[model samples]
Target: MLTLLILISVGLASAHHSGEHFEGEKVFRVSIQDEKQVHLMHVLANQVEVDFWKPDSVSQIRPESKTDFRVKAHQVDEVEHFLEEKGLTHEVLIHDLNKLVTNQFDSLIRSSGHSYEKYNSWEKIEAWTGQIAAENPKLVSRSVIGTTFEGRSLYLLKVGKAGSNKPAIFIDCGFHAREWISPAFCQWFVREAVRTYGTEIQITNILDKLDFYVLPVFNIDGYVYSWTKSRMWRKTRSTISGTSCVGTDPNRNFDAGWCEIGASSSPCAETYCGPTVESEKETKALVNFIRKNLNSIKAYVTIHSYSQLLLFPYSKNYALTKDHVELNNLAKAMVKELEALYNTKYTYGPGATTIYPAAGGSDDWAYDQGIKYSFTFELRDTGRYGFLLPESQIRPTCEETVLAIKYLSNYVLEHLY
Candidate 1:
């Protein structure tokens, strides 16, 4: 299967064309010491073409938080000058966005096809869905849950032994296009599932009784655009009517809060919730699948990256869920297991309090739909690397993540009543 994954990489190289170059663009991190600092950055964002790399929006930036953003080469001087003038403490995290992006490739030759260590193109990942299922017939099978606006298949892989009426966990990744590490972890997970099914006792038992529905890439069109046009692109690649703006943030496209807060109404905004709930085909597809499988899906895991956070429900607001204690305990246990592997620290709690309030998020939607174990994983490197985590670290990131996910799954299995 690994060999087939490598072979799949060879043919899809041309699908990704030379994208927008980030040559002198730099990523900056600002230390927000007070509401004054937060307000200052928020005001600056509106004045400049600043892109928030971490918080997703200026509204989410809070006092005492460190925000990461990318400023274009032409605007860096002005942005820095403004920061200095305002007395906001800040530093360059990525000196050269282009160099960091280039280093992320880790190889110029591109000999291999689909690799767990390397970020794979959508074309390669799409093909691997079919190939990996064929290679491991007993443990894996692929089906199309839906298609993107661009008509790419929304490949869903069911990973586990065939069973009569088993409960399952729904796991998805790549909701935002430029978060390449998100999809990388999904592929690594499926690979580990089939590779260690019988040899690894924990995975063995988990697969014996529970099925895992894995969507390797949820935002297909935008992921392709990120590879072929813009490396920092985030959102679905659907064209909104009456505007030239391209896409909606799928994370904010769910029905949980339906863009009530921590989301944008403007079509061009990064966190645009779409015209309405489940408006995007990808959002509809996932909603329909989970709805159809609601009876058996005991847990929901939506993977994302660069924050190393394990978050639970109520992302739409600050109110705690009824299962707050139970969920918090589980999250704490999961973090413990994850950190044990590499000593990679992970903070865990309710989403709104832990990070920022993000309405229409899939985890919140899933939890509201009765999947009590719904969780979101923001994986790896707090922001030393951000979305462009090096290929060399993929293995450890995935390895540690698997520990947390497996722990969560075990908890679900034990509590499924």
Candidate 2:
């Protein structure tokens, strides 16, 4: 069954060609500090793209006013003007529809000689994982931690040498669904892990001494929706029970300072925090798994895309953590290592200070759980491509990311007590 999915995905990807068109709709990326503000702002706008920074539906505000709002901006300058005039108080960037390109590294990988037999649907990724585990049983094992709202299996891959007690690193991707680069990075991480295990000293050392838990796709239902119905779906597909609104931002549903400053309470708002903390099954599953493994999990690393940032925790506000200095230093070192490969610049800083205040994020949750080395990597295109990053950049982005991860992992291994 998984094999069939891969074949279908490969065929679809290979048949894909560029120059296809969207509505040429004007899109503006807006940031609102409060959850209510996100709701009110979205309610007032004409046509807005929340960019998965916020949740959808399932909010703290009344559902009656939740709606499709659009910012008045057809061009970048106009967007700037709108931002200046509105005093919106959140970061708003206006962009046109000319940026999405399909010719990227993942696309190339799908169309390349890697066997259409191996490149199928989202299910097939698990099949590939199974095959890898079967062959390298000592270093790879598959675990079904929980199930998604849609009942899809949440598969986790624990990769490392055969051992009982070892410091571990936790990595997850595709929490936002639209950030396709996240899953691509997870796949790339697996590929690199397999290829460089015995070759690279640092990688080999880390793998031999520590375990890596990789969750390739966190929001499976939403990810499938992005591939099929809407390429921009940002939350899970679970219905909000009484309302017609669907999905909640899983990232915003965590219990860590949830729905306070950076999240929303309106069901129609993009950053909707959900009915309550850990309302989404997927979020609960991840939270429980991390909590169970909190002691040995030395670091938590999540991959997101199109921001070109290496951000550390405390995203809910601007308050600095005790390890801020060490985290910042490591981010700088990782950026230096990443830049050596592709010359792509990555802004490294505390999350709230670097981007905006985002409450209840997985990184912050992990940090609160005592995992100090928690980081989120937002990869590629400061705005050149947005969420529709072309496939051509996958290899370079993943390659540089691998360097950064390896550097960080080595640092963890050396300092581990």
Candidate 3:
């Protein structure tokens, strides 16, 4: 505990810690045609250290599907040999992850202040929340939802024309540390709301009727850790008592079928569900807020990246949600809205069936709490870039995402009966 606290303080106090860069890593996309191939892929993941990009875990790798994962440079040869031995068809989506990280910036000119097209650091984003709120007090105001385990304040921006007793939509981004594009979209959404409140008819109407509770970065400690320590870090920065690993997956730290499947009980796994439900302060903060505002919050929208999916609940199992038909229709419309821009197609359905079954997801929790319009937006790129989505694509990706989100927001407004 002492060591973790000291490290957290050091992480907070320092302007920069020497980056633990991702060098010589390759993202491989593998296609599975049968259960044998799926089992082989699972075996491969267990045998070597790899980061699951598409399905999230070995258990979720279904037959007749393509999955993307990253392997360290040292382990690439072994992975290649094993894939050959197993006769698994695969392609290298990213030749080198470090190169992708370096090239993430569209322009070498370097981003100044806070721009919509570039990924901002935690410091910059934290500052932007306060600045944006102060600048637009009428349409946007900021509040601290709770403090993270590392003692950093979690900022929640209430974006709408100031009002009371109005139905609200809770939108959160950057649930996973490595998914940089998630936070980018949240910032972009807020920017668009403020920019278009008066001129954009949809934005004007939605703001007049509903409020948006925007959480820019839910896992602040993990985000900072991703920037400073490991570029692939994907959990809260809090350390488990007896383990050397430092962080729990905040997305899996909620109480929705917690750690049942598609999540890990081990402290070291990527989808570690923490010691218990809401164990991480970040998770607790989000849960408490949502529970308190469950009445006024009519919809819950969580933003994530690299899959281009819009999914509804029941991630813990194959059981269809009771509101399946209505949610499915809304999802279909939203994806069509997404594709309207740049022809970027999106697949939408139940989270368990559409992608993979992940228990303890915030979306599932929200839906179970009676927020019928719960949706998880997995934004942009099927897998060409994986989590290293470039800065150049941010504008188009977020621009199109705005369409789908606006569509959902409006649907929630009309259907709030």
Candidate with top TM-score is: 1
- Put down candidate 2 lDDT per residue, 1-417, tens digits, no spaces: 766765665456434423233434444444455565555554444434433322223232222222222232334355456556765543433234423422232343444333221223476676777787787777788898899999999989999987888899999998987787788788888778877888988778889999999998899898887766666668888788678888887878887799887687777666778999999999989999998988899999988876789999888888999998999999999999999998999999998777667788899999999998999999987755667676666777888899999999999987774
Per-model TM against the reference? 0.95, 0.81, 0.94
Predictions ranked by lDDT, top down?
1, 3, 2
Question: What is each predicted model's overall lDDT from 0 to 1?
Answer: 0.90, 0.74, 0.87
Candidate 3 lDDT by residue in tens digits, 1-417: 766654553443233336555677888999999999998987897789988888777878899899999999899999989988889998888887776776665433234578888888999999999999999989998999899999999999999887778999999999999899999999999999999989989899999999999999999998998787777778888987789987888878888999998999989888889998999988889999999998999999999887888999988889999999999999999999889989998998998988888899999999999999999989888998888798789999999999988998899888885
Candidate 1 Cα outliers beyond 4 Å, as residue runs: 1-19, 107-110
Minimum summed lDDT over a 10-residue window in model 3 is located at 8-17
- Summarize candidate 1's per-residue lDDT along 1-417 as a digit string, tens digits: 755543444333323447467878999999999988989997899889989988998988999899999999999999999999999999999898876776675533345578777888887898899999999999999999999989988999999989988989999999999999999999999999999999999999999999999999999999999898888899999997799998999999998888988999989899999988899999999999999999999999999987989999999999999999999999999999999989999999999999999899999999999999989999988888899897878899999999988998888888995
- What candidate 2 gets wrong by more than 4 Å, as runs, is 1-21, 28-120
Candidate 1, residue 294: CA error in Å? 0.4
- How much does candidate 2 score in TM-score? 0.81
The clash count for each model shown is 1, 33, 0
